[model samples]
Each structure stands twice: as structure tokens, then as C-alpha cells.
Target: MGRNTRKRRTPLAAKVVAGAAALAVGGGGLVWANFHASAHEEGPAHHRTRSAAAQVATIDCPDVGQQLSGVPDRARGEVDGELATMDSQITEAYQRLATTRRAQAGDPRFVQNTILGPLKDRRKAIIDRIQLEIDRAGGRADDNLDQLAGCQGRPAEQPQNGDGQDGGGQDGDQNQDDNGNGAAGPVADDFIDINDVQPNSRASENGLAANGDGGSTGTFTTDCGVNENNLFNSDNLIAAPGVDNGAHHVHDYVGNQDNDAFSSDEDLANADTSCRNQGDRSTYYWPVLRLQDGTEEFDANELGGGAEGNVGRILKPAQAELKFVGNQQGDVVAMPKFLRIITGDAKSFTNGDANANSSWSCTGFEDRQVTDKYPLCPEGSQVVRTSNFQSCWDGQNIDSANHRDHMAFVQEDGGCPNGFQAIPQLQVRLVYDIPTPTVENGQVRNPYAVDSFPEQLHKPITDHNDFINVMDEDLMNEVVDCINSGEDCQ
Candidate 1:
């Protein structure tokens, strides 16, 4: 009696016709009064009818790998072929607005007057012609496109009444519910139609191989770049004002002065780095895997609204690994500079928890399947995700109480427990080239999505990560003398 406490049935004419199209779409008059005040109330089912204009708007652009390293070289092939057609129209507008249906997901002003205001005015005229071809090849135009074509407009609900709760309370057949609680009604789609699920054929048993027993003793790399910073805005700084303050969704930071959250510890040991070792200012972060394209352009501050917090756009990760797995008798140490760790489970997309350890694979596919359901990657190969952390810690908490009780998860031939201590086992790896979700007859249609929070839809295994060791005590003793001299430094 828990999966949100069963009991279903209620579409109330798709929530009174999506609350009368959000009061005929005029700033959704408080989503037509919270959809008739939760339309007859009920409990649990992870309750959520909160509306502040139904909360959506999220924009974060400008990190197409740091704008292709400031493009120069005579406009690097027309700014990499116009950022490959703007990442294929931002992954086909988030797969047509997350499969829109629920009685036309109540007007967020008709998805901002027809799809993200014309893809944010055609991505601000293609970042103003790639910032005039990177300022005529002199570079440094820093094309942020006015903070990635700022956006705003929410108000879209009514589609979650299969006892999964969320459909203006209950009342009879849009599907079923005679009270036995079998639940199965409002199907006019609300989201999560990653092509009716099933693709993860199961294969990757943690591929990335190379633990090679012998109790590993080397590896301490750190490239941490491209994911500049935009911790879902909430006033930029880390988890502002405390207790995971503003991170409603959207992440993509990287090391040290992680672009604010009051960075300290001497401001991340005097920050400044994209790490090829400028003394490894360790910070690292996650989230932000858009391509859902229903116009929330990877949202940031629409429902939470501004204060300079919800900045978006920041992709780049065709390849990124920041290894650190030591101790074969090496006794690695020195990671306390403001340490704060977290890994996987970002609400596992509303606690459905499909075996969440945060992973999704596809490179030439062999079927990986670990949950957040993913597949469709054939042509050339793409779509990857991996978030592995927890290197033992607990020599006096840097964070715990469910931020993962002081960390621990190493032994499976990887070692490091028995009163936890060995740090340096963080892995991130994300790559998404895009395109490959078109099957049709047997149903596949993907359009890559994963920048959640439209009532938490785009799952992709809720991949999560967040570290902050800001190395440098002689570069953390040169990563503990290159992992106790076993030597495999990158």
C-alpha cells in the first residue's frame, strides 16, 4: 500500500479540459486555480499540483563544448556547420513536447506561442551568426546569446490518473477504477512515452572495465571541462540558502569555483581551471541532458522564476572522465577542501526507482538496460551516461544523512572499506550525439530527452553526481604520489 497509495480514476474531462486551457491561456490564472483546487483532493501518490503558472521555463545554452573552444581558425567550418543544425533543432523539440497529449497539455501559451517562441527566435539568429564568426576569427565574443535566449511560460498539467495519482482527484472511467484500485485511466499521454518502453535489452554489466584486481593502485586523472557552470540558476551559487536550496533541476558544473554557490575554502584554493591540472580545483556536477524539446529548452527558472539562478545550456561531453581509484596499499589521502559528495538518485524520477545506480548506455548497442529505460542508438553510435561515486570516505563526515551517509561503495574487487577511508573513486562520463529514436511500426521514436521536472518526466535513469574536493595540497600530494607510485596519472 505505498506506490503512492494506489486508488485511481479521474480525468475530470482531462482536468476540466486542461483547466479550460489554462483559463483560455492568459497567464493561466494560477492554472485555473490549481486545477479546481486539486479537483477533489486525495493523498500521497507523490502529490504535486503546485502551480506558479504551472512552472516550466528553463533555458541554458552556450557550452556547445564551450562554443567549440571559441571557434576561430577562420570560423571552424562555419561554426561546425551551424552547431550541427542547432543540435538537430534541440533534438526535435524534445520529442514533440514529451509526446504531448493529456488533452493538449493545457496551454503554456500554446508552448510559448508555438514551440519555444520559434526555438528562441531561431536560437537567437544562430547565436548572432556565431557571434559574427567569432568576432571575425579574433575569437572571444563569448556568445551567450543573452543568456541563451531567455524564456518563460509554464501551465500545463492534467495527465496522471492511473492511480499513479495526479488528475484532479477521482471519480470514474477515463479508463477504470471501481475502487479495487487496479487503476488505469487517463492515457491521453502526460509524458514518459519513450516509445512505450522496452528497449534496454540488458547487457552492460558495468562496462568501462579495467578494475583488473591486484587491488588497483593507480589512476588520478582530471580533465573537468565543458559544462562550464549553471547550477540551475537559483542565484547561481551551489545549493543556495541551505538544505539543497535551489537545484530544482538542471546541472552541469565542473570543478572548484563551480561558478558560484559561495564557493569557499579560499574560493576553491583560488580557482581557475578546466583541469589539465592547474592544480585540479575539483568540483564536478551533473544533470542537464535535454533534447526532450517540448520547448522548456532545458528549463532553469520558469516556475522558480529569476534572481539570476536558472541559467541553462551547457552540454559538451563526448568524452570526459575524472578517475581516482586508489589504494593497493597506497593509502591515498588529502581530499578535504570543502568536500561534499553525492551520487546517483536524483529523485529517481519520482521514486519509480528502476534499479537506479544511474547509467544508460549505447555506443553500437548490445542492450544495457539498468532502468531509466534507454535504447535507440544505431547508425553511428552515441548516447552514453555514467555516474559513479562514493570512494569510502567517512573519516569525519564531509556530508551525510542521505547525501549518502558519509560515502561508501567500493568493494566488489575494487576495495576500500572497513571503516571507510580511501578516497578518489569518482566517475562521470556523458556523451550524447543525438538522433536515433525512430522505429515507427514497432515503436521507438526517441528524440533524446532528460532534463526533467515537468512533474519529473524525462527519466534517463535520473543520473546524478556532485563532488567538491578542490584538490591542491601540492595537488593533493600529486594525487597521493600518483596513487602510491603505481603510476597511471592523467
Candidate 2:
């Protein structure tokens, strides 16, 4: 006499975040793939909590009595302004892409960050960085954008209340005495959109393009005269080799997948799976920043003294776990805060994996609710788990069944209680700013713009067919000379 009950699984990005402790054990970037452990493996809720790791890395949360830097109003203004500018830049890039082949809509020459990373990551980073700078200058002592723009030495604001309180202005009686001056924390070198672009990242040099500006990592083409149905008619597989041999896919998007019948047939099936994985499912995770003196106050800031040392909570590690979801080795699963399930470095550019930094897709087996109360989270930015289903634990039994509670969030909790959903473009820019690891190297890379790219396009921009793979300088020069001499060409 047993009842038939079925509970859905959670995604890997939704899994508990792995802290520095786990990282110390030589664990790669967090993922619930076969490469990583599952929630049920054997650890307790607090097993791999990140607080200790954050502390060890000198990335501590702001405690009481600590002063925040930068002026809130100024920081907001700067971030908003930068976003507006980036929005325009992103648009311009898209327009350029449009002029290319229809298949080029997804071209890296046009954009990757805009398409790959979520829009919010870019937007938030810009504003946050600006605010960080404003805070560093004692909240109102900033010199210029140059000093402000650099992502280094940013602290929260320190207010001197009258009667010699903090933020009590220059040379105040009691205010000057309590202020413990320390150099601002170091800022990330640049902004990067993890989605479509990799930016200023070591990953980019390995073959990933920081953005469309750098170059294409790969390319996909759309054959003319093909609707969703006739996609594989050789004529339909855009620049396909030899008639596409009657190849096609369910969803037009076949990442750098090969053009073959099985690939085509399996594509639709996989696409169906990808979309199925997201049905009525949304992720919840908070992007917390250390509030400090002079730091900009927003949603979390209103709570009072939440800013950090000119540094706001920048890296939001919360994302879904890929294992619980149906994502597979090659497919991608999107998680809130720009977290996605990706394979390890095994798939490098050298191996034809463009974003050699980290393979972009997560393993498909371990999808479970990262938190029991994920169902209670509202749909919007700053989505945090609603329960105590904490971080990863090794050698423990993670009951994936607990995730059933998350479905309730889809019905309740509410969507963006702020009811604020930026147009696709703005959403992309805002998220990349700060408290979100927006900087890749030392530049800005937006992801929202990709929505503007026609869905017809596939793949990235880079072309490596017969590319010279020589390591020696003189040998490379000789090879280039031979090619230039036209022996091969002739």
C-alpha cells in the first residue's frame, strides 16, 4: 500500500555552493557533474560553507562599526550612465552583425558576452564598480573617473555623524579618531560576460573571444530557403558540406555540433529536453556584498551599514546544480546570477572547445534543489535560497527529493517583487557590473545584445580550419613564407 509520488530534480547550478575548503581539496570550479560530488554524497549542510573560505581569502563580510566608502547617489549615477553607454555600444555591435550572413547573427565578431552571459551581470558590475570607487574616496572625495574606474582599492563609506560620529566630514573631532584607515581592496582587472563572451580572461587567450570585438570562437551558418522543418536539406544546413546530406535538427541551435542526420534528429530531442528542464523552474540565490561606509545603498543597503571596504559583494556564487537537471555533456543549463553547468578544462580551445577557460555545458545527472525552499524564492535578481539546504558536503546522502518544495515558488513567492524587468538589453548590462565578477581582464563585455541577434545564426566567430598549429617562431615564419610563396595555393 504505497502511494505513487514523483518529485522533480533540481539543476546543478542550483546546488549548494562549494567554498574555498572544497577548492583547497583541489576541486575545480563548482559543478555537480560526474567530476564533482552530489548533495547526497556524504557531507553535512555546513561541510563546505564558503564563509570560512571567504575569510581565508581575505574576502570577509563587513561587520558592524566598519565604515563604507563612496557616495551612494554618485555611484548609482555613474553605474546607470555607464550601462546606458554600454547599451548603446552593444546595440552598435549587434547592428554590425546583422549586416553579415544570416547565419552570422550568433557570430563572435558581433557578440558573445551579450549572448552568453545574462544581461544583469554586466549592468550591475558597471554601476557597482563606479559606486565602489565613489566609496573609496571617503564617499565624497573622489578625484575623477580614471581613479574611480579602476577596479582596485574600493571600500565602503564612513559617515561622520554630528557630535563626532563617522562620516563627520574632514578633520572632525570624534570622527577622525575612530576612523581606521586602510588601503582599499584590489578590484578585478576588467568586466566580462560569462555567457557569450569571456573578456579579459585567461580563458580568452586560450581561444575564447573576450567579446565579438576580439574575434569569433566558432561559427554556424543558416542555409537559405529553410524553415524550421526543412533545416537539413543540405541547402538548409548553411554552408554545410556536400548537401548537408539531408541533415537537420529539432531546434535550429546546434552549438558547435557536427552537421549530420543523427545530430540533426537528436538536436530537436535535446532541445526539447533543454526547454523541458526549465519548465516552471526558476533559480534563487542572493548576490550579497559587504556594505561599508560611503557604499551605495540599494535593496540590501537599506538594511543599514551593509557596504564593505569600498568593495561591495561582487561575486555571487549561487547558481543551479546541473546534475539534478536533465542537462548533458554538451547541452547548457541556465541558472540565475549567470551560473551555468559547465564541464572542466578538459575541453580546451586546443581541443576545439572555444571557451577553453571552462567547458560551457554541465553534466546532466545530478539535478536536485540546491536548497529546499527554492520554491519560495521570487523570480527576480537577488534570488536566494529560501531554506537551510546549505553548501556541499562530501561523503553524505543528499536527498534530492527535498527539491519538490521549489515548484511552489513558481506559483507563489512572486516575480520580481520589484516588478522590474529591464528590456533584454539593459538587463544584460546591469548584471555584469560589480558584486558579480563582471570584469574579465580590464574591459566591459555585455551579454544581453545576443537576444537582438536573429536566432537563425549558430556557433561563434572563430575559424580554425587548417589553422597553423606551429609553436616555433622561425619554423612558423618558414611555414608562412611557404604559404605566401603560393606553393600550397597553386
lDDT of 2 by residue, 386-406 (tens): 111111111111111111111
Candidate 1 clashes: the total is 23
TM-score per model over all chains: 0.35, 0.18
What is the C-alpha lDDT profile of model 1 across 279-369, one tens digit per residue? 7877676765544222223332232211111122334566667787564433556667666776665445434343256566666442453
- The lDDT, on a scale of 0 to 1, for candidate 2 is 0.20
lDDT of 2 at 338: 13
Q: How many clashes (backbone N, Cα, C below 3 Å) per candidate?
A: 23, 139
User: lDDT of all predictions, in order shown?
Assistant: 0.46, 0.20
Please give the range of 10 consecutive residues that has the lowest summed lDDT in model 1: 178-187
- What TM-score does candidate 2 reach? 0.18
